[model samples]
Target chain A: MHISPTPQDFLDQSLLLIQARPKTTRITTTYSTTSPSLRAKKTALWLAKKGKPTPPTTTTISPPTPTTAPTTPQQHTAHLTLKTYDPVSGTTIQFVTREIRDVGRLVGVLGRAARGMGGVKTQPDTVMSDAPVPTPTPTPTPNQAVLHVAEADVPRVGSPAPTAARIGTPGPGGEKQQQQHQQQAGGSGGAQGKGKKKKGKK
Target chain B: MHQQLLSNEEFFQKLGLLFATTTKQELGSVFLTQKRLTPYDQNPEKSDTKPQEDTLADLALAETPGPVLVRATNGASKQNRDTKKIKFSTLIEPDAVDAFYVRYAEVCKSGMTALKKKNRRRKNKKKASKATKTEGASA
Candidate 1:
């Protein structure tokens, strides 16, 4: 027997479907060259026709609803992707952009309504199965020896120990440095004077 | 319009004359002969000796011989009331007359910058001299 549906039943269903629509879509073909404002205005216009009060605006434009999709900002995103969202029409927006991670998160929240043979309760494991496995973190072995070595390695920290061989009038650091320089100059001159007389003189 | 209240064009012209004078001139005769303006003046009592103070009708005939549009221009002073000049133009059209004003403003700005630099140099020299004097005194 063919069953007739009531008008209330049809309207309620339509409203439900409209509410379920996703808000944005991605296009794989990159159009980053185009103005983002224009694309957003166009999307806002499309949404406005679907009973939204106003279309999206370019400069700090308010979204029709709290869950409005944010336009892709700067940074190279997934290319050659197409995502279409229609919150009012209940369209499942396709996203070709690599911001797929966001879509996966949404899906995670609202999992498949029915699954298995006779609609079994969704297990946490099933929902997590689609999620990317996080890389296991290795136990950080703090090198106690390395910490000591690093503390010892700071060149500025070990600066207090100036050799007696480095003392003289300085602009603060001059005393330590001038003595070292004078000793080096004296030693070098003695070596050179001895060599010059013995070797080149003959 | 003047001493006669509405018929003395001579006196009205004299009023305009006093207004245009370079030096402030007093018209004791006009104020003294003029009857104090009052509602009773319009009662036809006429004070028997005088009529009334200057009304809209009288002043219109006073300031202007014919059709005169009262306008304030040339930054008319409020303290110097009882006289006004007429202006009929937006005069400062950006495209037409403002270019000279803009250029003049730019010149003024450049002059200001030069003056500031000169002042700064003078200040630096003064400070240096003061510093030298202090150092010599200390020594």
Candidate 2:
């Protein structure tokens, strides 16, 4: 028994089966490596189909013969079974991929592994068995409204208007200065309104 | 040969133990299978409470009917045919299983990179303080 130190090593050595039935979608994918002899047979068949003559064996150019092929392929071949279920119509549709040469290419069909199954936030369609049942957002009651108003007032009282140059200073002087600034601004506005009225009369 | 149902934490611990103890030759026998669980698998008695239409609607509005089951097994050896093979299973959210695989891959690629970064920072700080001390003494 060979122990794999990492997940990738484990994946390389063992068969991987993933069956997903998320919401309306249902799919199964299998990944397994083909033995060297099987790969050699495949290569021979492919060459025969293409009608290409077997090239002379050289030290540099390794032939795709059984003897020359590695003991095992470095990568796993993937097979996908897609099952579509319609609850309303009470119909189920199934589709399967004949062997995909490399599992990496299946990323396009399945999407990225991280986003697909990596986190709860990304996989909203799947059921979260251990997650706490989400409570409905409560409608704001009078008490809640009063608390909200109190919270809203705290900031207003703590931080006066921006006109206060020494804002946030812990003293009554800041508040007095802000009040004076506001009064000055109101007076200026009134004078400006009077000037505008005079210009209209002229 | 018996299949044992384990909690999430126990299952993870067992997996880690398997990873540590299994040899290269036994790697081929190790297998992890994941499958979606139906509502009936979750609670057989309660499954009858809701109509098919209502259940379907709820599933569509919320999430899938139930959690996913992940079974890990090491097949019996040829020499020791009667030996009890290792087998266990756990029910986990689909996304969590996916996240675990992703995290496992990351750990394999970079072993504790965050800790290495902290060590490097500490070394750099010490070097800077030593240099400053030496400069002050010379002055």
- By lDDT, the best candidate is 2
Give the top-scoring candidate (DockQ).
2
Q: Point to the candidate with the largest TM-score.
A: 2
What local lDDT does model 2 show for residue A168?
53
lDDT by residue (A63-179, candidate 2, tens digit) is 333332443333323233333333433444433333322223332233232222222334345457667798996887999989988976665755655554445564688778889
Scored against the native two-chain complex, candidate 1 gets a DockQ of: 0.00
In terms of lDDT, model 1 sits at: 0.32
Task: Spell out the clash pairs found in candidate 2.
Answer: A1-B25, A1-B26, A2-B23, A2-B24, A2-B25, A2-B26, A2-B27, A3-B22, A3-B23, A3-B24
TM-score to native of every candidate shown: 0.13, 0.32
The list of candidate 1 runs beyond 4 A from truth reads: A1-202, B1-90, B94-101, B106-139
Query: Residues A53-110, candidate 1, lDDT per residue (tens digit)?
Result: 6732445644322222332222221121222222222343222222322333222211
